[model samples]
Target chain A: MISFYPGPSQVYEKVPKWVKVAFDEGILGINHRSGRFEKMLAQVYQLLQEKLGVPADYTISFVSSATECWEIIAQSFVQESSFHLYNGAFGEKWCRTTKPLVAETAGYKFDFQEGLDLDQVIIPEDVEVICLTHNETSNGTQIRPSLVTALRENYPDTLIAVDATSSMAGVALNFDQADLWFASVQKCFGLPAGMGILICSPAAAARAEELQRRDHYNSWLKLRDNAIKLQTHLTPNVLDIYLLQQSMLERKPIDKVEEKVFTRYQQWSEFIPQLSGVDWLVKQEALRSRTVLALEGDPATLSALHQKAEVAGFTLGKGYGSWKKSTLRIANFPAMKRDAIDGLQTALLT
Target chain B: MISFYPGPSQVYEKVPKWVKVAFDEGILGINHRSGRFEKMLAQVYQLLQEKLGVPADYTISFVSSATECWEIIAQSFVQESSFHLYNGAFGEKWCRTTKPLVAETAGYKFDFQEGLDLDQVIIPEDVEVICLTHNETSNGTQIRPSLVTALRENYPDTLIAVDATSSMAGVALNFDQADLWFASVQKCFGLPAGMGILICSPAAAARAEELQRRDHYNSWLKLRDNAIKLQTHLTPNVLDIYLLQQSMLERKPIDKVEEKVFTRYQQWSEFIPQLSGVDWLVKQEALRSRTVLALEGDPATLSALHQKAEVAGFTLGKGYGSWKKSTLRIANFPAMKRDAIDGLQTALLT
Candidate 1:
């Protein structure tokens, strides 16, 4: 069945071939300290930078998942307090998770249907980091790049960290807008749900270095040091890294993927509003996400639609958190072709 | 090539078949919160308990790697000070890593050639946890179960945490001797790396609950709570977990595997002493490890021997850390057949 369950939704067509190659070449069992692994990691980093528009100065750390990144960011950079911009479930969860670790976590909650108002955001004097979720996968609302640019302009001293979990590769992100950007590979890289990629700008690295709290294994400094040597602080999932490398090899250019994705989202966003029995979660066009299309409907009708989609060989994403029964979250990740989205739309109408 | 690189050496023979099954079932893209995933995780946990003798009261948390366990232990259990029993590189590294996180970390280093002297070991009044490595993979020496039993008897109030990274499934560990036990899947479970299993006994759970420092996503308490529902705190490497579960299915029981490993190690320990060039690192037979055979010799000769073995379609583990040139580490994990070890012996003699 066709799957569109947001992150970990679908894998690239090349994964099977790469898995075979990894098995044949004994990639899984190779020593992490060996020259082979070092070379593999170096190439993987290079591919990531090239394909994702990561800055040449930015360092990438391969971690377990996006949630781990939240802890790393909190421990390494947020020495005192972090100001979070929250609108949806994911944003709220991030703030709640970071509150206990940091000295203080303050958030300005926006309506789920509305975008962040930069004028209303307050950064206390002791705030060390400004946290924002670029794409809230839970409600299909996304933060515009202008908001990040505004925050960077206003809070030049504080580090800006962006959770780009659901939109990093599916769309073009202004890398310079935030000091740290992170995404899990399952969303747009079309890999499985085991690895996370964290991009740290020089500014973010400086903030971590200034704090020098290298208490955890995946501390930003330790991760950066290991990345410099083309390795991780611990034995990572070498097979997943290999799989990601394969997915990035000779694929459609990131820009092309983004264009296709946005075009499909644009069409669907217009068409979905005209459809009966469902309504878009985010009211504002600019606040809508290009990666995940969250549609709110009657709980019974939504459940029936999900079941009917499955019967038609398509699987739609169930709503997350509190909206589990009333909303349908459809992933428009790079791996989802235009025809597939069209099929989902037809299935929904039927 | 026949791999013998200690951990992440050779996976179980049926890994590819199981991976194919996962792919066929679309396991990679399935939601972690789905009923299907819950069933898979429950079965995996059951297989681990049956195969490794994990206590019925103990809970398991699937994490990224063994190193993550160190951070979890330090944060969740070690409120102030921890006494580490250090011997080789790994043990020392654990102590060093934990030093930065806990309020105070102290260690007594033993010579690589010797095991821990329980009678001489000191415990300070404020020491909350005692850390031990079950198998020092670097030097091919293992801590006998008697030591853990003695420690448990003497320090009933102190938490005992075991880093069973290299010898968990290859040996029959007394799970009751330690409050927490963790192992990486690549070693004896015969799966690729990237996933770690953390087994927390009732006492360990009590410590975590008493402290209630569930800030981080992978905090011990958070992990335990999630484990109750057969889930991890974060999106784990689904493919690796599936591979591990497959490896556990219909495999040799832990006792049978342990007997085979010990018998093989006994034969090798006897045969290697008669070899012309190489000598065993751990002098005492009782202290020698059953999983990894660390053989020391002239650097040039060892390198040449490793090359010869590779040419003969067998790959041997190069010396690790400081003994990079003078040691040949051979993995005798469950995946390695008796004939393969015999073949390695013949090649080394040649």
Candidate 2:
């Protein structure tokens, strides 16, 4: 079956071949500190930079998952207070997770249905970090890239950290807008879900070094320092890294992949609105995410629709958080095939 | 090649089959909150209890790695000062990592050559947690189980946490002796590196609840609460967990595995002492680890010996930390076959 779950959704078709390559190469047995691993890490960083348009000076580190990124940012950058601009459950989660670590955490919650209006956002003077979710998988809302640019332009001194959990690879992101960008591999990279990629600007690295919180194993400063040598502070998921590298190698260029994903999402969104008893979660067209599309319907109706799709050999994502039963979320990840999207359309339309 | 690198050293021979099972079963695509995942996690916990003697009152949680465990424990359990008894790099790393998080972290370092003697340890009144490394993978030393029992008796109020990273599955640990036990899957479990298992005693859970440090995603309270439903606080490494479950399924009973490991290690240890220009790192026989065996010798001699074994289709672990060039380490994990060990013995002896 073709899986369309939001995250940890689907593996790339080429992954089985890559897994064989990893096994044949004895990838799991390589010491994390060895020259071979260091070389592999360096290549991955290079690939990410080339594919994602990450700045040359930015440092890339591998973490366990996107959730770990929240904790690491709190420990490394949030010395005073953080302003969390949230539109959904995941955004609120980021604020709540940071509340205890920092002295203060202020949250501006947007209406989940309407999503965030960038012009209405206010950045407090004492907030050292501004946390934003690039795409809210829970509500299918996305903060436009222009807002990221606006935030950075307005708050030059404060750090801008974006959780690009669901859209990093499928969407073309302007890496210059944020000081830190993080995503787990499971979402758009079409790999297994054990590792996360953390892209940090030099400015963010400086902020972490200034904080000097040397106690945690994933010290942002240490991660940065070790990252320069193409190594991690811990024994990372080597096989996942290998798989990610191989998947990246096997895929088309990022721009082409993003175009393919956007084209399919656009087609679906156009047809979804025309369907009976179904509407996009976000009222604002521009605010709706291209990757995670949340469709509104009655709870039982949505469940039946999900079952119908499943019987047709297509798995649509379940609605998350408060919308768990009332909505059907579909992931338009890069790994999603054209036929699967067509099948999903056919199953729903019929 | 027969690998002897300590942790992340080997994948069990049956891992390829298990990985296939995971892929074919679509294990990676299941939602973490789904009943299927909950059932799988429950089965894993049950398997662990039956095999490892983890107490019924203990809560099992899965995290990314042992490094993450240090941060979680420091955040969740350490209310005030923590007394760290360290013998080698990993133990010292635990203290160093905890020093910044707690109110005060005190470390008593044992000589790397001599290893830790728990009987001589002194606990300060302000110390709320006593941290020990059940197995110091870096230096091939282990704290005896009796020491864990004695410490629990002596410091009834102080919580005891053990890093059983390299020895948990290859040896029998008394769960009642420690408030928390954690180990990465790469070592004794013979799985690829990516995830760790954290066993928290009910008393430890109580201590975390009393502390109430719920700011982080991996707060012990949050982890414990989620674990009752057989779920993790964040997205876990689903594939690794499946592999671990499969490895456990293929293994003999824990006691039997432990016996086989110990017998093989005993035979190797006997021959090791007789080798020309080679001696054990720890003088005390009881402190020498059953899984990871570190041997001291001239740097050149060790290098030549390592080369000889490699030419004979074997890979020996290089000494870690300061002994990187001067020693050869051997791992006697349960996954290591008898013939492989005998081959190494023959290659070294001849």
Candidate 3:
């Protein structure tokens, strides 16, 4: 089936070929601490930095998943507390998950469709880090790079950590806008769900070192010590790293992929209004995500639509959290082919 | 090259074929929380239970690595502190890693040439957990099942956690002896390095509930909550889970595999002693690991042997920690082919 599910949405056509290459080259059995592994890791890191346009000073860590980054930030980046600005469920979950780990966490919510109002939101002086979701996968709302860059200007001292799970590879994000950024490879990388890419500016590293919370295995400072040496704190998912290297080697640069993503997004934006059933969940066009679109309908209607899509060989993402039955999400990732997109649209019409 | 490095060791021959099946089935693109994924996970969990002979009340959690399980146990299992019994680097590393996270910790190290003396070991009353390594990969030592079962009888109130990374699938472990047991898939399961299996008993679950330490993403309580629903707390390494499922399906039962492992261990024991140069690192045969063999040699001799093995198309594991230059390790895992084992012996003879 052609999957339209957001995150783990679609496999890149070249990935199967690459996996075979991995097998033929016997890359799966090498020791993680060997010189060979170090070289492989270095190449993958450099490729990501070049293709994703990350600054030279920003270093990256290979983690288990994007969710683990929340733990790392809460454990090591915060001295007292964190302030969370959220518009939807995924963003809210990150804040709630950090509360018990850190001394305190305060969250301020905004309307998902209305977008963020940084002008009115107040940050607690004790807050050491500000957490925000760059793309809210659960609600199909996005805070653009430009907006976060502006937020950086407003809060010059507070470290900004962005969850870019659904948007990283499909969008061209300015690395200077945030101190720490993370995403799972299952989404835009179009590989599988096992590894995460954590890119951090030197400021974030310095803050982690300052807090000195190296108690946990996932402490950001501990992670950095090994990462700077081109190694991981623990035995990593070597296959995924190998796959990521091959993926990045073949992927068009971020800007080109972002252009295609926006064009595809525009097609969906114009066509969804003409469809017989379902309406956009995010009313403000500016707030809607470039990588994911959530469509709202009654439960019965959405269920029927799901059935039709399944019968026609396309699997749509069921809604998450509170939107479980009322909405369906579509991924507009970089590796999603034009044919699959058009075919999904054709099936929707039927 | 046939890898004899203890882990991320030789992969199963069938894994590449199974990966092809995964690609054709489009398993990589399926959403992790979907019904299809849940069923897949349930089947994998059941296969492991049946094949590994884990107790009925013991539940399994799929994590990123065995190292991550150290954090989970420290975070949720111990009420005050843990007492560690170690003979080598891997176990000592675990203890040192936990010191910062735990309130207090004490370690008793035994001679690697000898075995653990349970009679001489004394654990404080406040030590709520007793940590041990089932197979110490670093120095090729082991703590057998009967010993741990006896340890359980001595401290019935305390939790026993075992790191069985290199031996879990190759040996028939008595799950009743420990409250928690963990292993990485790249070793005995013969899969790529990306996932870990954590099996926890009902008592461990109850203790986690009593502690109520749901502070982080990798918390045992949080992981169990989702695990009971046949879901992972985060987007997991889906590909590895798929591979594990296939690996378990084709695997012999734990008892049968254990028999093979012991026979292979015997073969190596016979062959290594007849070789020209190296000597056994552990003089006591009873303390030696069934899945890994360590040989003692001078630094220059070991380095030359490594080069010789490379030229002969075999890879020997370099020693770790204190034994870095003076020793080498050989894996006697289940997936290693007999021909490769014999071939390595021939190369050594030359």
Candidate 4:
């Protein structure tokens, strides 16, 4: 069966084979703190850093999922105020998780058709943290890296946290520009949706250490302490990590991976307008995401197409929140083969 | 290589085979909303309830991990006050997570030998929630089911939440008696770490619905709503769930499973005292957990034994927190073979 739903996306064919070896070899039950488990985790993290081109100083902490990372960030930072740039549902959800803290949030809602306008959005000087979703999955809108570049120049003191959940492994991100970056393994990493990889800048770690409030599970300082020993704050998803380690090893360099994914997305962008009663949801070319393509069509026609696609063994993502009826999201992560995309194009045209 | 580290404990031998099937069959990437996923999850929950004897009204929500369940409980139930019963490290960690909204915490430090004192611990009328760890993995202590029964009788209005992280499937737990019970899939489920199964009473759902401010991601209301559709609030650990589903189907009835595990523990308990300079960490036999047998030994001897055991292809759990220097934990879960335990005993004696 072909699955086109954004994530849990497809995994490498070799992953299950490795999982079999992992099981048959009796590595499944080992203590995560043992030397054996530590070596496994270290290898996984090293491979992750190597694949993502994360700087040597940046440390990777694997947690349950990207949603937990939101809590980790809010619990660790946001002691005073956090500025959030919201464009869609996922961004709104991120902003909502920060409710427990005594922090003020600033929201700028950009049109789904346009990229983040750094010039139009204002950040107060006192805002201690600024959070943005690098790619808005709900609407298939991409935030240009230039936005982060601009933030570093204008708001030097503000800690930048990017939720690259749907973009990280599919694109090249500059880790030095952001204080904290995190994503789930399922999306572009082409693994199951169990583990979240979080990279923290030393400055972010220091900020977490200075926080006065007691944080037990989501505490970045506690996580940092554990990371020093190559452990996690709690029992990790070992199998998912194992699969992710294998997936990263199978990935090409960022430039090559990004080029292929971006080109496939460009193909979809150029092909969609040729169809009757179909158009892109995020209308502007520059704003559309390379990994997730949102399409707007007549509601009845989209519904018919969705049912037809499912019957033909392609499962697509529904438009989230307000756009639920009129739109469909197509994922073009590196895991999707060109043949599969070609099949989808043929099916749609038919 | 024999891995004996107590949890992320050893997976069932059949686990990898089923996992490979899940991957090879292309069932791994299906949208959790699809009929296929819903059927798989429904079967999983049904089997779990049957095996665990959950009440008909209680609903099980699958999450990324047990720690995320803690965050859910914190966000959902602890609006006015929470009372945490701490016996060991995991228990202490739970208490630490509750510091933000805790009205007051009743810290009853029990000797590693004794279990929770049901008579001495008082649940205040004002306490909105009562949190406890069912099995203290750190000190190898297990709180008797009688404690929960007493709480339910005396404090009918207060919601009861238990973290059965290391116990659940390893022993008999009365799911019908508790308002909310959650455990990780790793320890007793005979699977790799990633997912958590949370069984919540309708009363707990009502309490969550009453909460004025709930973080969106960890909010029980959102989770419960999503669970109705057999989906999670976030992208779940799909592979873990598949493995867990396989485990649930393969699990023997609780009576037989518990009996087998208990008999193994009995053998260890009877033999542990025979070792020179070694003693049970929990003072009383009644308080010692059947799943995790905590032992206190001379540091030098323990170190020597640990090395010998490692060479003999057996790995043991080190005592966490204060007991780290002098304690060793032995897991007697169903997945642990008798020969492995015998081998460990031989290694220790040598």
Best by lDDT: 3
TM-score of chain B taken alone, candidate 3: 0.98
Name the lDDT value of residue B88 in candidate 2: 86
Task: Note the DockQ of each predicted structure.
Answer: 0.69, 0.62, 0.79, 0.63
- Model 1 misplaced regions, further than 4 Å: A270-275, A337-343, B337-343
Mind giving the per-residue lDDT tens digits that candidate 2 earns over B299-345? 87788788878888777888888878777889899988778888888
Query: Which structure is stronger by DockQ: 1 or 3?
Result: 3
Best by DockQ: 3
Give the lDDT of residue A135 in candidate 3. Answer: 94
Docking class of 4: medium
Model 1 DockQ reads 0.69
In terms of TM-score, the best-performing candidate is: 3
What are the per-residue Cα lDDT tens digits for candidate 3 across B62-141?
99999998888998887679889998888998999889888888899988777877898888877888999999999898
lDDT of 1: 0.84
lDDT of 4 at A196: 86
The sequence of per-residue lDDT tens digits that candidate 4 reaches over residues A67-143 is 88888888777686877887999988788777655457666677666667788887888988889899888888888
Worst 10 residues of 4 chain A by lDDT: A209-218
Quality of model 4 by C-alpha lDDT: 0.80
Q: Find the 10 residues in a row with the least total lDDT in model 3 chain B.
A: B269-278
Residue-by-residue lDDT tens digits, candidate 3, A96-128: 989887777899999997889888899886688
Q: Give the TM-score of candidate 1.
A: 0.96
- Candidate 2 local accuracy as lDDT? 0.84
lDDT of each: 0.84, 0.84, 0.88, 0.80
TM-score of each: 0.96, 0.96, 0.98, 0.93
Candidate 1 docking class: medium
